[model samples]
Target: MPLEIVMSVSFARAGLILGLGLTVASGACAPLRSHQGYIIDADLVNSVQPGVDNRQSVAQVLGRPTIASQFGAEDWYYVARDSRNLNFQKPKPKEQITLKISFDPSGTVKSVTRTGVEQIAKVDTFGKTTPTLGKKRGFFEDLFGNIGTVGAAGAGGPGGGGGGGRDTP
Candidate 1:
């Protein structure tokens, strides 16, 4: 083969390999989208009318709820979240929907409430340690601070003889 043709072929192969590598690398950085919990269908959700729908009908139309009320009024919550994560980052919610169906004692739906992403709260954590009320102590203090207090007076220790016990002369 001619030297010029040989060099041109080698360069073409290298360019093609480099282009493919770049494409693959770019795809990896793209955001990954995920859907969690109940899948919402506008028509189906709207079809459930208050006062007309009961537990059996609601379950058939919307399936089981994400969570049911543990206290107070009987309610069913259908939660849906669409999240996106780029590369190795934690997934953040891009959209959220919380559908609350409140039922009366007779199992009839009292009301249907829909909440959107506006209800999402963003909480910023301080660090690894939780923020607690009370005097902050050092590592050594936490380890040894209780040494003298364990058997101290009025501590209900073996010799402390709490006030509830009968007095001995």
Candidate 2:
């Protein structure tokens, strides 16, 4: 091969490798996704006093809550989670913020509470077997269930079989 051609080929291979490495590295570092809810500034959250701020005023300053209380409509919850998910891997939450705002019967802000990642709850499943509906049977029963249904499928009833084989005669 010509020296010039060999040098150009080497440079092309190096460039290709650099480009592929960059692509794979970029994919491995998935962009951080922020699941934001009720985007209100921290200063605004503090500005709305419990005793002084009313529902309308608080709504104007801070947006609506991400979710309301399950049992009642007075409690408002503002939550946000920052997570990174690469490919098919489960999303790992890097940061989480939850703001709970309570309202009195008069529709005025009563209190504001905030919680961070410390509140994350770890849930453990009971066992490896997923819940399925059916009665548990032995291995023999499972193996014989289909095998025992053979005579019932042909043109024969219980204890009534027609054998054309010469051995049966």
Candidate 3:
């Protein structure tokens, strides 16, 4: 290769490598994030015995639950998720924990359970259509459907409308 051509090729290669390095470095420098709901420690959760812990004792140990059942069953839930996102892309879920504690009517912990991300359920809609009861018309039919119906209901004026005081012959 000619010296001039070789030198230009080396410069181009160097620029490409530098650009790649900067891209990789920028990603590596991004802060790893753990956006969680309720960050409860495993040891603390174990401290509360299922049969022994009452509402107050559990509250004291685990603090208030992230959410309590609003309807029928009395269940306290502590859920947390760890995710990391690059720039503004969708965050990737690294880990998830869900602890559900059921309480008896007497307000004592009845059962304690721990769950992982595997329990997550992905729901999907069935179809992209809705069934309705109505006549389906074509685009052109709907556009010109009312064109000749405007004054058909009454003479250009209101039906039965009184005319001038002088009666027409």
Candidate 4:
């Protein structure tokens, strides 16, 4: 091949490799989407009327609830979350819907309430080790701290007891 053609081919190959690498890198950076918990159907959810729908009818329309209230008044919660994450990062909620169906004593739906991502609470964790109130002990101290303290005076050792409430005769 001619010198000019050879150089041209080399440049073409380099361009092709660079393009492929960029495509793969861009794909890696793409956000991964995930849906968790109850899959909401708008029509079905809307069809369930407060007084008209009871526990059985609600279940038939929306299926099982994500969680039911264990304490207080009876409430069924249908939770749905759409989250996205990049690479190996923790998934963050893009959108969240919580459908709360409050029930009366007769099992009839008292109210149907919908809440969005605004209700989500972000809690900032301090550190890996939880803050505690105590004397900070080292590894060796925790391992062998009770060495001499086990049979020490006033610690219910063999010599710690008085002579069984009797006088020596």
Candidate with top lDDT is: 1
> Per-residue alpha-carbon lDDT of model 4 for 1-169, expressed as tens digits?
8999999999999999999999999999999999999999899989989898999999988999999999989999999999999999999999999999999999999999999999999998999898889899999999998897765667666555633345458
- Each candidate structure's TM-score, on Cα atoms with residue i matched to residue i, is 0.75, 0.66, 0.60, 0.77
lDDT of 1: 0.94
lDDT of 4: 0.93
Worst 10 residues of 3 by lDDT: 155-164
Query: Where does candidate 3 clash, by residue pair?
Result: none
Q: Considering TM-score, which of the candidate structures 3 and 4 is the better prediction for this target?
A: 4
lDDT of each: 0.94, 0.80, 0.85, 0.93
Cα RMSD for candidates in order: 6.1, 8.0, 6.9, 5.5
- Please give, for residues 1-169, the per-residue lDDT of candidate 3 as tens digits: 8999999999999999999999998988695786689997989999878779999998998998998999998999999998887766767777889999999999999999999889877666658976678998889998898886654544353343334245569
lDDT of 1 by residue, 1-169 (tens): 9999999999999999999999999999999999999999999999999999999999999999999999989999999999999999999999999999999999999999999989999998899988899999999999998898875778887666655466689
Candidate 4 wrong stretches, greater than 4 Å: 1-16, 143-146, 149-169
Q: Where is model 2 more than 4 Å wrong at Cα?
A: 29-33, 85-87, 131-134, 137-169
Measured with C-alpha atoms, the lDDT of residue 135 in candidate 2 is: 93
Q: Whose lDDT is higher: candidate 2's or candidate 3's?
A: 3
Clashes of 4: 0
Q: Write the per-residue lDDT of candidate 2 for residues 74-119, one digit (tens) a residue.
A: 8888888877777777777788888888999998989989999789
